[model samples]
Target: MNRLSTNIFRRSDALKSKPDTSAKQPFRVRTGFLILILSASISLANAEPQNQKNEILAELNAAATRVETVKASLQVGIPHPTAALVQWTEALVAYRKNPEFLYLKGYQPLVPLYFLLKSDSDAFSLFVPRVYKVFRGKNKIFDTSIDIDIALIPQDIILALKPLRINDTDHTEWKLAKDQTAFELTVKDKEGKILRKIIIDSSEHVRYQVEYNDAGFPYLEIWKDDWRDTGSIFFPYEIKMKRSLPKKNELVLKFKEIRPNEKLEEKLFQDTFPKDAEVVELKESSG
Candidate 1:
């Protein structure tokens, strides 16, 4: 469902590790890359299912109050790690400034919107949907048929937004302000995972303090914490995401500017292809 958004990579050099144990490792097969094969759509799994409809309506009663945090919870599961030819973490980190390839990024609301989560091998996807056009990197004039399932944020507010995937629970937690910010929580199905902790600041402007414990590894810290007043509410201006445990993979995105609640052209939401482009076959991930 969200193979388009995870930004997973296929680094050639990562396939070579020391000792050269297996002189003949078959074609590079990265579990991480293969994890992206499983997909998802807008109709996400929110366990709240039937009841959440009522909850959303109930929250709309005031229609003028604040809602706190929002999140996507997916239990981390991996049959095995990716088969990289070598351990290239240090090499990649040293010169990753120039990534050979990049996945097309989708939408992530400056303001909290609903998220659709699809779990893959070890990696997962969460996306915010809308009707819009995306210009290709090569030709800015050409429009592409794209339904992105991932979003990015710059580093900051790692603490403010306590992102978590606990062993138990369906809803992620965000400390709601007194008629201020609130959230949509996400947790994992891992037997002993503890939820990440985030403290929301709803004073004049909103901010957070997020932290957590994973497999007894101490990884508690506040990150890229910065917020801006969006007239009606407050939101993080700087945000970042990374692997919380077992690994140090990361994704960082910065918002050049944010335009809110704009109308979408009906044509964009359709599967029509623009002229000069091939009609790509898009599979349906949802029933």
Candidate 2:
């Protein structure tokens, strides 16, 4: 006989013992009952961790939903590693969700810079008062000349302040830290490429986040601190973003005033530049 048949015959001979007639039950039935119990125990043990992950995800979504609109006055700091002092400027930023609109006005020394985004139409406008120029475009936000402008992307800015709501389409996996003080949540796209990874503390506040580029490289690392309670939701007063490629640069925003869920005026989303201001329509390079 083959090895497989010999093993089966040995198992059959092993169960050929006399049945326990006193208990009024067959041994095989008792053994089957034990196997069923073991299977149920294993299933429950596997379900518990998944249940915890679901609860954590629900809490994150609940917090994100509480933020509808936010308007803040902030101090923008660009740090130079070689220089002794950091370049500081002031800015006013406002954004609203559920269509996604953002308006940023930066007070530069030479002139004020205005950036507006309307996600519904995928349109963006940049106004530079110094040059009396207004550049309007669609799809792309910045030009190739602006190397350190990734931090100024409207979507990234909004994500840094407001946490993204985990949706059904996003593949998410989380694991608790060894010390159980925090958990790391990794969100990936349908193609299994990591979109972003967030670290949340015990209080469910996002401590840090790493955003990946299209080529699956870490492009930006963000650290959030000094959370402020804005009644409706918790807002991070201090946000620092570190760029990894081309040249390492850091941009920090210190929010002086944060107002959440405020009713923003419609005019804020519109372009109110002077008619005489030279309109420069930025076209996408065919290359």
Number of the top-ranking candidate, with TM-score as the measure: 2
Per-residue lDDT tens digits of candidate 2, residues 173-199?
776654456778889988899999988
> Which 10-residue window of candidate 1 scores lowest in summed lDDT?
88-97
lDDT of 2 at 130: 63
Taking all chains together, the TM-score of candidate 2 against the true structure is 0.70
How far residue 207's Cα lies from its native spot in candidate 1, in Å, is 4.2
* Tens digits of per-residue lDDT for model 1, 1-287: 35533322323344355337334432334454444443221223222334443444343322223422222221111112344322111000000011111112232336233322222222222233342222222211011222432222112122223222123233343333333243333232344354544433423222333344545443434334455544543445454444333233334333333322233333323333234433233322232
Give each model's whole-structure lDDT. 0.31, 0.71
> What TM-score would each prediction reach against the true structure?
0.29, 0.70
Clashing pairs in 2: none
